[model samples]
Target: MKKIYITFLFAAISLFSSCDDWLTVEPKDMVTVDKALTTPEGYTSALVGVYQILQNVYNPGGFVMGSGVDTFANIYTEPSIGFSQSLNSAYNYNFSDTSYDNSSGAAFLQMYKAITNLNVILSSIETTEVLTAEQKNFVEGEARALRGFLHFDIWRIYGTAPDDNAGTSNLILPYSLEVSNEFIPYLNYNDYFANILSDLEQAKDMLSFSDPIIYYSNELLNVEGSIEEYEDLGWYNRQNRFNYYATLGALARVQLWMGNKEQAYEYAKEVVDAQNEDGTRKFRLGTSTDMGNTDLALFVEQLFGVETLGYDDTSYSSYTAHCVNSEYVLNQVYPSSSDIRKMNLFTTLTSNALVYNAQISLKYSLMSENDASAYKNFPIIRVSEMYLILVETAPTIAEAQTYYDTFANSRFDENVTLTEGNLQENILNQYTREFWAEGQIFYTYKRLSLTSLPFSGQEMNTDKYKIAIPSGETNSDL
Candidate 1:
């Protein structure tokens, strides 16, 4: 359980970048942590630094998001030649392979690095004289939420499932709370999740009163305006941040994972029913029109996500090269040809002199003529997922069917029937279609403890669901 902490200097300078005026800190301006955090601008930059880590770790090619996690789910077809060896290892569940282990290990360290930064902010934000009381609440709330968010992912990726009785009792991963290099003891599954929920609940309480998203719509807050206009408004771009709704959404997800079905249903319903002052849904489901216009990431429906740079260029190139599924697999996942996802989310690449013909996902690929900046959104949570949660956690089978019908109607112009037997199958199908390269379907299989995967009928077990902890982490004290 002994873990080393990244120094404040490295966390601040290495992760900090120019996203906005407040966050524009140059690496040349080397200053101690105390001096950097003396001003409101410095604290803001530090928080933005944590977000920057998210942008890096969850980008399309990052281990948690695109190639790594999706490959673990067996979402792609390995080409006859020139495929990435690391991804091939992931697809085969070869976590012990050196390349795959190194990739996953790097991502693990990056997440903890971000957590260290968050701990630094939380430790200093309250007593800082430069920030107002409201500013303190906002910063602390966001830090707590991000802390919970990062720990949840770590547990999902590395810890045993709560459903496993023996695994639940065994000490797993340390939930780091302080910015110290001291050894922290690992906790059982119950204690680990309790820490996650504690952070989230405290965050929810603080953000409810302090977050601007509570009173204003994301449309108005994120609306394009002059620099002076935005400066006057204080905070903008609530969609990308862990806003109030996103906290609730995260709660619902965690509750469902821990088998708190009633709580999950309630939390999800609140988010689904949330509205702006104008009565429009806070986060609406994406439609065919959105896909037709090349907004394939469905930016409108994202509850919480990061706006990434080069998502379509560098990050997506990895997908096009190694993660392309064959036409046959795509058909199996999307049985309804009329489904809008099927129609717009895929394109067949013709065989060339060097590469063979294959079907690839357009979810992350943006057209050149369109506003690429607007489409570079990488969703971590969406309203569509809230509906999915509702379907699974609904009180009765009929209630589940109603939620599914609503979600299905929004995606395409179709009337699909649902019954008790097929309801669970349909839900799984939607996960495959809705979150193809978004890195969620794999976790769904794990949470449900499915003995077989959907498309390939690959055998599954607890060992496959849990990734091996990186060797460096295992032998850290040495």
Candidate 2:
């Protein structure tokens, strides 16, 4: 029994990296919270296990699962939907119903699995005599917040996910995890956000302990200790776990999405104020440094993200071990003075480089063997976003100016300030440039109901903003 349970535990952790046994962990096997969290290691393992799965939720090399691991959605590059419209299958763009339908399953599967783990934590924390009350609450908060965070992701993608999981009626994911044949309840937009906000609001208060180490390296680098020293206190740092914080960010984001500007401003402010000890803000700007400094520093922006914490050392390394070289932005990089990402951060290819190289994949640079691993962890909901939310939602132009001024000047070294007539556009455009390659680009475009003027060549539809509910999800139930 011990061996079987232990195997299940290890298998869960292994799932994140496509480990031999990890990929096969079945969802049907029931492991009680009491049994899973019997020890501190068990509890930690459960939490970390879910996070590891996040690394694999999407395939990073291409679109779909890891496509937009960092904030930038890499595969979607076009005028419609702004950057991610697909011209060919190779581009792997899924801006409409099909993408959302398929993605919802994958997203829901992982989130539900994590939620189950959290449910276990929530249920057992009370019975476990060894765990402290605060510890129990912290863990529970992490789980609930994470559950809310992922659900919000689903809602964002599908637009009408419901609270009830009847499976037959609503949009849900993971054909493998479904236990019921009945229709699932699809959440309306308002309720979707309400649940998200509720979870985050509680998570904000539930999380107590704080770990100051803000950067987390890929576990693969740990072979050389590159990913090993992720924390100053080193035993898994669940205290500053991203699942909870991500929930807070989702709350602010959903609030903004719902046009509750005041609440958006409120929650976003909360996240900004919760910076790392060194004052390097979470989900803020990248490390404005030269890229070639380490040949592997190209993507160092997200090295120590909350999700990367406690994950296996080789996860990121393996993800980035093999990458095709691209030079779409060589001009951007060579000019150096244009955007700092090209100038100081990215390197110009030499005589041996390919002439048809695409843009320098501005979000991340090469790690080992020119794979995407070098790009650091990009915060999905960084502290800077909160400020932007406030500025955009400011009650008046003067208030907007005040918030926008502080946020813009502080985010980049250039110190951008908005002028009178172009207040909203200025802030929105700045968000585009500042957070390019990061995933928030589309959302920014969405909130404003603005469409790209025209890309270099591609045609974009201003009306085709919200991805329609995928046909797979539009059964008789919804």
Candidate 3:
């Protein structure tokens, strides 16, 4: 199916201001809830609207700082170019004051903005009589899950996030249920994760179908479920509703971050169990075909496919910056044939360190057919991710070896086998190839809290992983 996600005009529209700056992408105006969803169809469309924003606004993180021009690359790039920097482990960012920009923050703000859109739908759900109770429950669940997911993202990226459980933090974000101009205290981390999981659990129960719809499986929720796409005539080829499952996947990640390894394992295992054995794991690896390219690059272990919304160009995949544009993570070594990711996602940068040409991307190709050069609803989370996580987090080296081979060999050459003491190394190696340009590397390193990777024969420490909230943030009256 042709993917057509939403896109916002990133014009310089004023936020909390009426300034005429050409850079601000402000809403032309607000519409009442009554008009937005006068019917059931209207309400679901609004949900898709929120999903579109999620896909468009949040791009993945990177392995190292580089030419990507995001905070991700900024850290390594800044320090590499002689800039004094400090690390913030929370976001895995090295945010020296000088490198701050509006891009990453803008994405965070977009997340909140997406939350607001869902909030509007929710506010309407309570009052609208046109939608059924079942529909209302499902939609509300999905909306809450989206909010929790976004807040969770912000919590990870922002240093001092709010928590409903720990109400008395010195710094916290305000919780808004309606349109408001007042700044609120942030929820502490405990409350934050709690609410995020709460939403996911609820949505998982209520989520009748995914965007590419799915069904219950007796074969198990791992590598045994069928790989058929559930059709939703009402969904208009949208996957935002399918986000309920992803909510759980993301929760597993959140739990892992919070150091609840057991819970993380449970959550991840659930995803693995939710897959079909045909290698179409819950979040199966994306073949070069998945990228819609003739090149035979295969990205193994597509844990979760984040739906990609609309775009205006082929210059980049949100992850492109980390792959081809920056340090060239793929060129770090000769990737195996089983590791078809670089072959399909990037063109080798063969410039002898001079011209440095060739691009790493299979995503931007969709720009041509898209009306405004944008794609939509790329999978954000998948089952394959769970298998990989399960293997890495396995309690025993033997168990880890067993799971790693069972899950990984499907993508790598038969020569690949977990060697003694190389379990972690192999896992990280798979992690790198699996998410080469996708930005999960940043999270993996931070999650493991390890420093230094051999890139082109040089040991590099991941600068302390803290992305400084711009100093100007406090200066602004949110």
The Cα local distance difference test for each model comes to: 0.76, 0.45, 0.49
Residue 341 lDDT, candidate 1, scale 0-100: 90
Q: In candidate 2, where is summed lDDT lowest over 10 consecutive residues?
A: 1-10
Task: Write the residue-wise lDDT of candidate 1 on 1-478 in tens digits.
Answer: 4343332324334333433312333453233454567766666667666777777799767899766888777777743324566877777788888988889988888888788778878877757787778778888898899899889988888776656753356777778887665555677788889999999999999899988788878778776452343353246788878888898999999999999999999989999999998899988999988887768989888888887643445335443466576788888887777889989887777752223567777777773225543656788989999999999999898888889889998876356677777877788889988998888888888888888876557898888888887776664563
Best by lDDT: 1
Better of 1 and 2 by TM-score: 1
lDDT of 2 by residue, 1-478 (tens): 0000011222233233442222222243223434456665456556666666665453333232234322222222222233222322112234443443454444444545555455445555657875566566556677667767766665454342122232233333321112223333444444455566676677666763432222432233333334443332123433225544555666777777766788877776666565554565444433444343532222322322323222232332232222212454344213324455444443333321222332334333333233435333433455556667777777777777776766544434344455567777667666655554444555565456553421222322432343444443345433
The per-candidate count of clashes, in order, stands at: 0, 50, 63
Error of 2 at 184 (Å): 3.1
List the candidates ranked by lDDT, beginning with the highest: 1, 3, 2
Off by over 4 Å in 1: 1-35, 79-82, 224-234, 310-320, 352-356, 367-373, 476-478
Return the clash pairs for model 1, or none.
none
Q: TM-scores, in order shown?
A: 0.89, 0.64, 0.70
TM-score of 1: 0.89
Of the two candidates 2 and 3, the one with more favorable TM-score, higher being better, is: 3
* Superior by lDDT: candidate 2 or candidate 3: 3
What lDDT, from 0 to 1, does candidate 2 have? 0.45
Full ranking by TM-score: 1, 3, 2
Q: Which lDDT tens digits does candidate 3 get at residues 1-478?
A: 1111112212221221321211121142222334456766556656656655655564433112222223342222122222212212122343543433444445545666676666666666778888667677667777777776666656555533112223443344434344434343455445555667776677666664533334432223323223433223143222334444566677787777776778778878776665544545444444545545431222223333444433343434332233343334445543565455555555544542212554445533443335342233333454556767777667776776677776555555345556566767777666665554444565565456454534422222423443444443433443
Error of 2 at 234 (Å): 6.6
